[model samples]
Target: MAKVKLKKLTKKFKEVLAVGNISLDIEDGEFLTLVGPSGCGKSTTLRLIAGLENPTQGDIYIDGQKVNDLPPQKRNVSMVFQSYALFPHMSVESNLAFGLKIKKKSAREKQEKIRWAIDLLGLSGFEKRLPKELSGGERQRVALGRALVLEPKVLLLDEPLSNLDAKLRLRMRTELKRLHKKIKTTIIYVTHDQAEAMTLSDRLAVMRDGKILQVGTPEEIYQKPKDVFCAGFIGSPPMNFISGEKVPQVKDKNIMVGIRPEHLSVSLTKIAQAIPGKTSVTETLGSDNYLYVDISDQLISVRLKPDERIPEDKSVWLFPHQGKLHLFDKTTGKRI
Candidate 1:
């Protein structure tokens, strides 16, 4: 395992800047994920690190050694792409052993490594099956095994779970986390799915247009985002951003307050210690309720308690948890 560091790394495809000047330090043995929407340069950066694409500028280091001139084969990294990139005619064992064979390992060593890899990935029975004969999850496992057998210093996964169905994706996610824990290799994963990033990563770097917007644990990025874009990006139903001024009530002006869905409290009337609002609409989600309220000339969402239900087709009062509110610089879109 190795610490991967990118110092002001940049990649440009002629006129368009694929990756802006970016810098990040992925700790050794850390399951670090790079997450963002499409065109955010997550994949570009990953490619640069893998030496699949050369950076337009900047330096890349693996364990303190500059590897800017090294090719992908010399980088000591394995890439697991979205496509799974499996050989159609090769059986699982052959597929896993192909790389070692090319590197000219001894026959006994190849057999030993293949056996160990198959067992490690629970692919013992499927070693003789070709990619076409295997299920999606099994094929994915084969791809993982192939990468793992290489014993790469770092593992680069680019949206490896995107091909799986929803149920399988969820299952594979748990399996991927388990694999990471057991292998203890430095992993840099790139994905658009925030939930996957949150669940699998020890630390996640949120990217936008080739720049890292924020880097933190899932809780930190969710509960305390550095800006509005991050607050809006990493959640389901996301955090609500209403264009409201600093409604000075008691202390400092809580200007451009951000309230997560779960941090809001709904009631028949506004509480004495919270901001007042008129209910716009309420969505019932079986165990929980979502209340949309017009407060301070903006609409915000509130999460209702388990046993509570919103009175239908009528305006209700909402009390926002002031302590949970996040204040931001409206002009700069930065946390205040």
Candidate 2:
């Protein structure tokens, strides 16, 4: 229920700059995700907001109040880490009631809150179960419920679903989206999984080397990436890049042309304006097939329907869809 803001926030670990100067504004009740590769400072940024780590420079504001000098307990923020830090020996209800007990809430108040959390998280039958008795997903919910019982003004999650199996992770994603809608609390999430970030965030801040490369909605970043790294990173199959000089349609030699796998079509025969290549491999993933074509020693992937099949080592041609090409500077890798 609060808006968070960062002004030139920075953190340095002696010789290493963990988080470079960066500014961001998270709207009230909005879910914002920071996504990037490992060591990209996404986790560091989340820790700064949670008061788990102090920033080297700049300020953090929550609900328009400067919180850079405040301790984590006084900041009204709750964080869930990659590992579900649940109390191993405690029952689910006890885990949920621990924070309320620390704050010395009345017995009735604690019971009411614990019941609410259990019901909210769909754990009605598992209240007496310990962490060891619960499934991975159930245990994760206990950790989340423990955080929620405190009614924090802001919730921070750092790769909270990374430990779950793929199917369980998908289910958790759906649960998180539903939870956000019901509570409307401001959430700042950090993860390296682009698919997870895209599924859960209202806005995404793509980071690289301790700096934010771009910030936008999932569709915005996917359809119109501002730079080469973003263009290559956000998609499942990822966008394919080719030297502009190798493309007959491109006039600039000092640039690179990017076409997503879905934006390129595979053809066995040469066509008008087609780029010739030899088929390298094909990957069938239930609903869709991905064809890899080697063009001038560079492999380009093309999306195909599940029914479509192309032989390996077969000569093929590629045709880019109109208006789908992305242009970037060869030297700087910036969008052109």
Error of 2 at 81 (Å): 1.1
The estimated TM-scores of all candidates read: 0.93, 0.98
**The best candidate in terms of TM-score:** 2
> What are the RMSDs of all candidates, in order?
2.2, 1.0
lDDT of 2 by residue, 1-336 (tens): 899999999999998998999999999999999999999999899999999999999999999999999999999999999876888899999999988887767899899999999999999999999999999999999989988989999999999999899999999999999999999999999999999999999999999999999999999999999999999989989999999988878957899999999999888887878889999989888888899999988999999966788999998999999999999999999998
Q: Which 10-residue window of candidate 2 scores lowest in summed lDDT?
A: 244-253
Model 1 scores a TM of 0.93
> What local lDDT score does residue 284 receive in model 1, on the 0 to 100 scale?
82
Which candidate number has the best lDDT? 2
lDDT of 2: 0.93
RMSD of 2: 1.0
For each of the candidates, give the backbone clash count. Answer: 0, 0
**Per-residue error at 231 for model 2, in Å?**
0.9
Stretches > 4 Å off in candidate 1: 246-254, 270-288, 294-299
